[model samples]
Target: MKQQIPLYLGIDGGGTKCKARLEDAQGNLLGEGLAGPANPVRGLALSQQAVLDSTLMALEQAKLGQGQLPSVNACLGLAGVNVALYANQYKNWRHPFAKLHVMSDLQAACLGAHGNQDGAVIICGTGFNAGAYINGQLTEVGGHGFELGDHASGARLGINAVRRVLEAIDGLCQHSSMTKAITSYTKCSNASALFETYHKATPSQFAALAPIVIQYAKQGDVHAVEIMRTCAAYIDLVVERLQKLCPPRFSMIGGIAEPMFQWLNKASQDALVDPLHSPEEGAILFARNNEH
Candidate 1:
């Protein structure tokens, strides 16, 4: 009689963190791990390191050594994998496990939400992006990046709120509590300091200020509240665009998903569906289904 070889591993690489799951061939999830962002767009070395770190963590947790891991296949659904900026890194990843497959972070989100079924996903977290699955094709709706896009993401929230505060200080906009909140969050003493801080600081750190905006918005601060409202509008725009493009079933993902949900238009909210699983689970599902 022939013996069955083992297969396992699923990874969800995000902007905030990476999640790795170790499952048996029979589909029993055995171990899991968490680590920093694996978005290749963030940096090649950073992204690869994130994935490697998180995957190793999971294996260690699962009590599976490298020899055991090598027997298991892996599928990495990584954020920013679709972007061409990190193309060089995408071609090469350090993984002892075989049967490796690379896909965009949003691809796993869509699959996780619908179990490889046709669907769309609206993700709002540190960054905002939307993707669709139609007839096995990956079609992205938003996700233009943090500069002028990512309008509905946490990074966008921080950038927009701070900019509003800066504008208000110049008397171009009305005074707002957000001005103080922004200053406090970044630990900038004054306007000049804030400008200097921006040039020296990373966008990821500024994006971390999103929680402050969320807090103020909940407290009814007008500018802060506007940030949330505006965020919803941008996400809704993507949903509407995806609807026109594919009109498939859509689900939500990410940390700020609930906030986006709360502020979405009633019609948009009505169209939402519950996610069947997360990107991590979807990556596992991929590994399980595709036997090496």
Candidate 2:
């Protein structure tokens, strides 16, 4: 009887979505899957379900069955795992994979962006975080979660936009096209309606409004531009701090990274390089390098 070749799974699980990639032992791509939000900080049960859902989808796409799960090795780069409590809780999950390795999404992104070489990465997505790997040491900054930090993140931008819109509606501030755009997007004609719409909004739900802010900023709306400038300033600070680590390369990623680039200072703009791979691929490299 011949032995079966090993299968590997790489997962990049973030506040907005979870992505999975399946590869053969020789590093050939097999299948991929995407699922909903998987940040444990938001909800541990939801995160776990997302991971499993994406993995099963990948398995099906790879023409494999659930029975093959025990033959697969998986590495998960997950958002919110930087918190010790969430990290330990995820590490103890009764997962279906043959072996599981877990790490923060920022670490996996840096590895992927720099091809597992020494580098730094700033993720400006639904949440914000920066990480650098240099000389076998990993340095991380920000990512304190939505309630506490996540400066320059989409959630922050969205919340700021909403605040501006509300102030404009209430006659507390001058209204602009940006505020009008936000009210239109939210279908809210008054402060009371807007408040009802977002009083219990999740980070991802807030992030959904960010594109409107970016669009208005691009159109030269005063309030939108001011918001974007603030966002850029925070990102600039993050870059300055990470550059002190002196990584050979640096990359900015996530949904807002490109749009926010124009608003960044020249120094921060010049410091960035294009990423070589996706975070999911970074998870694969991590799994391979750490496989026992």
Candidate 3:
């Protein structure tokens, strides 16, 4: 009999965007795909569509076609895996791939960070979330959606920083560089108009404001510095708690985490770990569906 060709796929689905990669059994990446936000909490339909879109896009990018795809194993690192509602809903998703493995985005980050060893990973992009993997088991904290939590996340930074700017403008807080910088970004004639964006903007849009905060902080803006500091502290608290929960080295992913690492105290920063691999690669590493 002629030998069958082997193929595999890895997916990193997040609140911001989804990334997919096609690889061979020996782990050589062949092609890639990019998709939309896959947060189940936002809405099941949206999450499912985004994921499916990305997956199909990936297949198209690889040019493997369906017959070759069915033999491919897929690992999906999603944003809202902890919510049983999401998981249950995901159970119904049908794909052409031979097998599919799903996990929280943090789990994939852990796999990317420690490669299946014991460790903790914090995701700090639009919203915050943390995960611990010990002995192949996964534990998670935060990521409870925007209103309930997600401290130290990009969304929180922007929301908080903007609020501070409003406060300063209204004499609620002392004047600072943050107010001037934020006011420039808002371009609002008056504070009352600021509500326009706040009322209509999405969480990711708010998060995009984080860079303004960071910029003001570098210029010695007290409010901006405080915002960044508070974010760092929240991240520290979560990681410290995870340490008690898992007792392993700590690592981080997402935009917030990469910057927060710089703001952490030297000792805490010393223990930081750069991701050993990307979440896309991590998906392929643990996927059992890959052909040998």
- List the candidates ranked by TM-score, beginning with the highest: 2, 1, 3
Q: How do the predictions measure up, each by TM-score?
A: 0.91, 0.97, 0.89
Sliding window of 10 residues with minimal summed lDDT for model 3 = 1-10
Alpha-carbon runs more than 4 Å astray in model 1: 1-5, 85-88, 245-248
Which tens-of-lDDT digit does each residue in 1-292 have in candidate 1?
2213575778888777888887776777677889887877778788778877887787787776656656768888887767766644677766566778787878878878888788888887777678887886778867766775788887888878778877887888886677787877678756687788775554476678888888888888899988889988887777787877654678888877876688889778877888999888887777666764
Which prediction has more favorable TM-score, 1 or 2?
2
TM-score of 3: 0.89
Better of 2 and 3 by TM-score: 2
Candidate 1 backbone clash number? 0
Task: Give the number of the best model, judged by lDDT.
Answer: 2
Candidate 3, 1-292: lDDT as tens digits: 2214556777887777888888776776667888777788777788777766776776676665555667778888888777788888888887666788887787777887777667888888888888788876777888887778888888898889778877877888887777777778878646678877786676777888888887777777888888889888877777677867744677788877766777776655765677788887777777843433
lDDT of each: 0.77, 0.91, 0.77
lDDT of 2 by residue, 1-292 (tens): 2226588889999889999999989999888999999999989999999998999899888888878888888999999998999999997899988899999999889889999999999998999889899988989988899989998999999999999998897789899998998888899999899889998899999899999999999999999999999989999999999998888999999989999999999999999999999999999998888778
lDDT of 2 at 68: 85
Off by over 4 Å in 3: 1-5, 65-69, 245-248, 289-292
